[model samples]
Target: MRNFIILFKKEMKEGARSGKWVWLPIVLMVIGISQPLTNFYMPQILEMAGNLPEGAVIEIPMPSGEEVLIGTLSQYGTIGTLLFVLAMMNVISHERQTGALAFVMMRPVSAFQYMASKYVAQLCILLISLAASYILTWYYTNILFDHVAWTLMLASLAVYSLWIVFLVAVTLFVGTLLRSSGGIAGVSVVFLSVISLLTTLLPKYMEWSPGNLRAEASNILLEGEWGSSATLVSLSTLALSVLFFGLAVYMFKKFERFGE
Candidate 1:
């Protein structure tokens, strides 16, 4: 426990120094804010950009607050996910490449502790950034459209967070398995893309996949419920995260010795 705490703090400090603490939330906030603002001003924006006749009137219906919020989440599903995977792709691999893992291993720290610390620290940053972005989006959504239930929005955030956590676990696991950051990022992105495509194309069978979390998040926003399948998917995602973390630790323990 003490070793985990120490390593967790080290990871936090590394994140802070990397400017991830500042820029990641900022990027998410921008994505959140843009959705509502664009939806609210679509008519005016169209008038300015569309070169239509002077008498032609555009009557675009404003999207519901729920839709805007869901759109914001979709933005995170794409750009935010990519950013997180890219940022964390080298967490373990870089240490191994630099011979830092050898020095850390020489101490009393176990591989599980090391891997858990990285996962927890990265998960913390992801949650904080997503929370800030969601809150901002909710605020703007209320101003532009109808009020979204706070409880429902928060629940959606929690569900969606599980997906992000799963992504983090996968990133770390891939990092531990692969030495190159580019390889980690490429493989992670490809895996995520394939999962997303499969879930979308085969919702019945893939309902319990982590990739369904995004759809569940949108469903929660739009209908305030995710039904029975959400529970199954959430549990599966949580279990997968734990399994990935364990795999990462096992891989690190096996391969870290070769770094020396």
Candidate 2:
């Protein structure tokens, strides 16, 4: 536990030096704020850009706060996910390449402790960024559109957060298994894309998959009701994330001797 704490703090300091603490949250918050602002002013934006005939009326229906919030989440699903994968792709690989992992292993730290510390540090950053972005989105959504239920929003955030954590675990797993950051990023995106496709194509069969997490979160906002499978999905994703982390630990230990 002491080793985990020490390594976790080290990871946090590394993230700070990399500017991830500043840029990631800012980027996500910008994406969050932009959605509601754009939805609210879409009509005027179209009027200015559409080059419509003089005095021609354009009627654009304003989306509800729920819709705007869901749209913001979609942005996170794509661009935000990519950014996270790219940022974390080198977590293990770079350490291996630089002999940092060897230096750490020279101590009494276990592989599991090392892996868990990295995961927890990155997870903290992800949660903070998501919370900031979601809070800003919720605020703008309420001001620009109808009020979204606080309970539902919070519930959705919890579910979406699990999904993001699962992705981070996957990134760590790939980083441990692969030597190249580019390869890690590529495989991680493709793996997530495939999971998404499977869920979209077979929702009923893949209800237990983490891929359903994002849509389930959006549905909570849209319908204001939790799905019956919410518990099952949450449990399944959480288990999978742990499993991935364990795999990463094993892989890191196995590759440690290679010093790759």
The numbered model that scores best in lDDT is 2
- Cα lDDT tens digits, model 2, 1-260, are 99899999999999999999999999999988999999888888988897799889988888888999899889888898898898788888888789997799888888888889999999999889999999989998998899998898899999999988899999999988889989999999999989989999998799899988888899999888888888888999999999998888888888774333
Clashing pairs in 2: none
Clashing pairs in 1: none
Model 1 alpha-carbon miss at residue 82, Å: 0.4
Error of 1 at 20 (Å): 0.5
TM-score of each predicted structure versus truth: 0.96, 0.96
Model 2: runs farther than 4 Å from truth? 257-260
Our model 1 lands, by Cα RMSD against the true structure, at 1.7
What tens digits encode model 1's per-residue C-alpha lDDT throughout 1-260?
Answer: 99999999999999999898999999889988999999888889989997799799999888899998899889989998898898888788778788987789889888888889999999999899999999999999999899999998999999999988899988988888788999999999989889889999998898789998988888888778767878999999999998988888888878775333
**RMSD for each model, in Å, please?**
1.7, 1.8
Worst 10 residues of 1 by lDDT: 251-260
